[model samples]
Target: MRKALPVLLLSTALLAGCAVGPDYRAPALDLPEQWPEHVLLSAEARADWQQWWRQFEDPHLDALVARAVDDNLELRLQLARIQEARARLGLARAEQLPSVSAQAEAARERTPGAASPLGQSSTDNLFSLAGVLDYELDLWGRLAREREASEALLEQSLFAHDAVRLNVIADVVATYFDLRSAQRQLRITEATAASREETFRLEQLRFDVGESDELALRQAQSELESTLAQLPSQRERVRVLEGALGLLVGMTPAELMAELDYGDTDLEAIALPDGVPAVLPSELLARRPDIRSAEAGLIAANAGIGVAEASRLPRFNLGGLLGSAAGDAGDLFTSAAGTWGLSATVMGPLFDFGRSASRIETAEALAEQAEVQYRATVAQAFNEVRNALVTYEASGERVEAIRRQVTAFERTLELAEVRYREGFVGFIELLDAQRALLAAELALSEAMRDRLTATATLFKALGGGWQVEG
Candidate 1:
C-alpha cells in the first residue's frame, strides 16, 4: 500500500498539469496617433478629466453629479449585478477545494423472526456520527478554467458598473445645461414681450390722436400678441426641463413636482473649456470601461472553451469518511465502534451521442462572437471620440458666428427704431428688425447650450476619468 501511494500521488500530479483548451490574449487594434484637431494636450488636464464638470466652476453642477453617482437607480442596479458576479466567482473558486460535511443519525429497527425455528422478535438501536470529505482532482483543469471564467466575469461586472456611472454623470451635466438654456430662453422671451407691449401702447395713442392709421395700429398689436403667445410655451419648456434634471439627479416624484433649486446659475455664465486635447493617444482607449468590459467578456468566453473541452474527458474524485457506529448511543465514541472508509471515483462520458462535442462547438462559437463584439466595441469607441471632437469644434465655431450675428442684429434694431421715430422708415421695417434680433438672440442662446453639452459628450467619449489598475 505504501509503495502504491507514491505512484498514485505522482500520477495525479502529472495528470493535473495536462489542462485542456485554448488560452486567452487581448486582441490587437489599429488606432490613430493623434486627433485631427490642433490643440494643446496637457497631462494635468488628462489627470483631472474625471471631474471635468467642475471645469465649469459651478458648485451646483458638481453637487448634482456627486448625488447622481451616489443614488442613481441605474448605477445602483449595476452595483447589484457586480455583487452577484462576485458571489459566482466565490462559487467557482470553491469548486477547486475539498468539501467537508458532518452527519449524525440515530435509528431504531425491529426484526421479526417468525420464520425462524425459535420464532422470536427483536428490536435494535443504531447510532452513527461521521465527518465526510470529498475532493475532485483537476486532471484536465476543468475547475481551474471555470474559476478563470468566473474571474473574468467579475471583472466585466466591475467595468460595467463604471460605464454606468460615467454615463449617469454625463447625463446629469447635459440635462443641467438644457435646463439652464430653457430658463435663459424664457427670460429673453419675457423681455421681448415687454418691448412689443410698449410699442403697441404708443401706436394705440397715436391712432387715437389721429396721427396713425388703423392699419399701423393693428400691425403693432399683432406683433405684441405674437410675442406674448410664446411665453406659455417657453415657460412649459422650462418646467419640463426642470423635471428632467430632477430625475437625472435621482429625485423622487414629489421632488420632481416641486421647483428644483439651481442656486442662480446662468447658461451664459458657465465657462467654456479653451480647447480639447490635440494628441489623444490610442492606448488611452483602454481606459474606456465599455471597451474593457467587452474584452473581459471575450476572456470569459475564451475560458469557457477550455471548460467545454475538459468536459469531454474524465473527472476524478477522492472521498473519505471517518465515523463511529454503535448499537448503543452511549457507546458511539468507543474505539470498538469506530469506522472509516476511502473511495476513488472515475466518471466519464462513455457514450452521449455527441452532446460533449456539441458543447465544445457552442463554446467555440461564443468565443468567436465575443471576439467580434470586442473589436466592434473598440471601433465604436474610437468613432465616438472622433465624432465628439468634430462636433465640439463645430459647435464652438457656431457659437462664435452667432455671437457676431447677434451683435450686428442688435445694431440694426437700434437703427430701425431711430429711423421709424424720425418718420424716415415704415413701421414694417422696424418690426422686421425687432423680429430678426429676437431670432438671433435665441439662436445664440441655443448655440451656447449646444457647445456646453458637446463638451460634456466629448468628455464622456474620452471615458471620463476611468483608469485601469496596474
Candidate 2:
C-alpha cells in the first residue's frame, strides 16, 4: 500500500487537470496558385544552389561574397540569437526533470539549569546531511508548449541569418559592378577631353590665318570647354564609387586599386528559362524566409495562449528528500541514521480577476497580426519578382540598341579622320566625330552594366537561392 500511494497520487493529479488554453493550428488564408505574371526563371537560369554567387563567373566576386558571409556584422548578430534560443530551449526542457540539492549542517548548544525547563546543564552536538529533488509533472502539456515555442524561435533565427547572407552577396556584386562602370566612363571622359583640346587649337590657328570666322572659333571653343567640364565630374564619380566599394569589401580604396587593373570584362546577356517551376501560393507560405519567421512567431504566440491557460489550473510539484542525520560524522551513512521524506503539493491562482483572460486575448491578437503580416509579405514578394523580370527584359533590349549605335559611331569617326587628312574637312570636324564616338562607347559600357545588375536583382527577388534545408 505504501508503494501504491505515490502512484495513486500521481494518477489522481493527472486526472484532475485540464488545459485551459486554446490549441494552436495554422490559420488558413486564400492565396494564389502561383505567380500570375511571366518571369524568365528557366531551368538553365537556376545555378547550383550551393554556390549561387559562382554563376557570375568572377573569382574575385566569389571571394568577396564568401568573406562577407563569414564576417559580416549582421550575420554574426543572428548567430548569437540562435545561441540564445538554444539556451532558452535547454531551460524549458530542464523544467520537466527533477531539481536536486544537497545539504550538510551542524549545531551545538549548552543548557545550564536542571531545575528549570530551560536550565539543563548538559551539552549536546548534532550533525546532519541531506539531499532533495523536485519536479513538476507536465500533465497539461504546459512545459511542452513552452519548449515548442523556443524551438520555433531557433528555426526563425537560422532563416533570418540566411537572409542576411543573401543581402550581403547582393551588395558586394552591385558595388563591384558600379566601380567597373565608373572606371569605364572615366576613360571615355579623358578621350573626349583630348579630342576637344585638339579641335580648339586647330580653330585658333584657322582664325589667326584669317581662314575661319571668330564665330566659328568661338563655337569650337564652347564645345571644348563643355567637354572639359565633364572630365572633372566623371573623375569624381570614379573616386566616389571606389570609396563605396571599399566599405563593402572591408578594404581601403588604395588597397583595392592595387589588386584591380583597368581590364574590360564582357557582361553576357542573361536568358530567362522558358518554364519556371510552378510554385503555388500555398507553397509560398513555406518558401519565403520572412513569412516562415512570421509563421514561427504565430506558432509561438499560440503556444503562449497555452502557457496562460495552464496558469488557471492548479500547478503540481513533487519532491523527495533523502540523506542521514547522525551524532558523529562517520555514522552519517549508517542505516540507523538514514532518513527520507516525500511530498506532493499544488497551488492555484484563485483570482487574478482577468489577468489570465487578458493574456490569452493578447496572444490571440498577436497570432492574428502575424498571419496578416505573412500574407502581405507574400504579395510583395510576387510584385518584386515580376518587376525585376520586366526590368531585365528591357535592359536586354537596350543592350542590342546600344551595340548598333556604337558600331555606327565607330564608322563615322573613321570616315571623318580620313576626310581631315585629305584636306576636305577641318580638324574640328574630325574632333566632333571622335567626341560622339566616345559618348556612344560609354553608353554601351553603361548598358552592359545595367544588364548584369538587372539579372542580379532578379535572382535576389527569387529569395536568393533558398536551400530548403529547413
Q: What is the C-alpha RMSD of each candidate to the true structure, in Å?
A: 2.2, 4.1
TM-score attained by model 2: 0.84
lDDT of 2 by residue, 179-288 (tens): 77777777777777786778779879988999888976887788878878887888888777766665665554566666543235433322322333334446556666
Q: Name the lDDT value of residue 162 in candidate 2.
A: 66
Clashing pairs in 2: 33-280, 42-273, 111-120, 113-119, 113-120
**Which 10 residues in a row give candidate 1 its minimum summed lDDT?**
276-285
* Candidate 2 wrongly placed segments (more than 4 Å): 1-4, 7-20, 36-49, 109-123, 251-284, 409-440, 466-470
Q: What is the clash count for each candidate, in the order shown?
A: 0, 5
Global CA lDDT computed for model 2 = 0.73
lDDT of 2 at 200: 78
Question: Model 2 Cα displacement at 286 (Å)?
Answer: 3.5
- Tens-digit lDDT track for model 1 on 1-470? 76886788689978897778998987877888776754545665555445778888888899999989888889889999999999999999999999999999999987789854678888889999999999999999999999999999999999999999989999999989988898898899899999999999999999999988998899999999999999999999988877877887788988887777877799888988775444365755577899999999999999999999999999988899999999998998898999999877889999999999999999999999999999999988988988888888899899999999999999999999999999999999999999999999999999999999998888888888633233
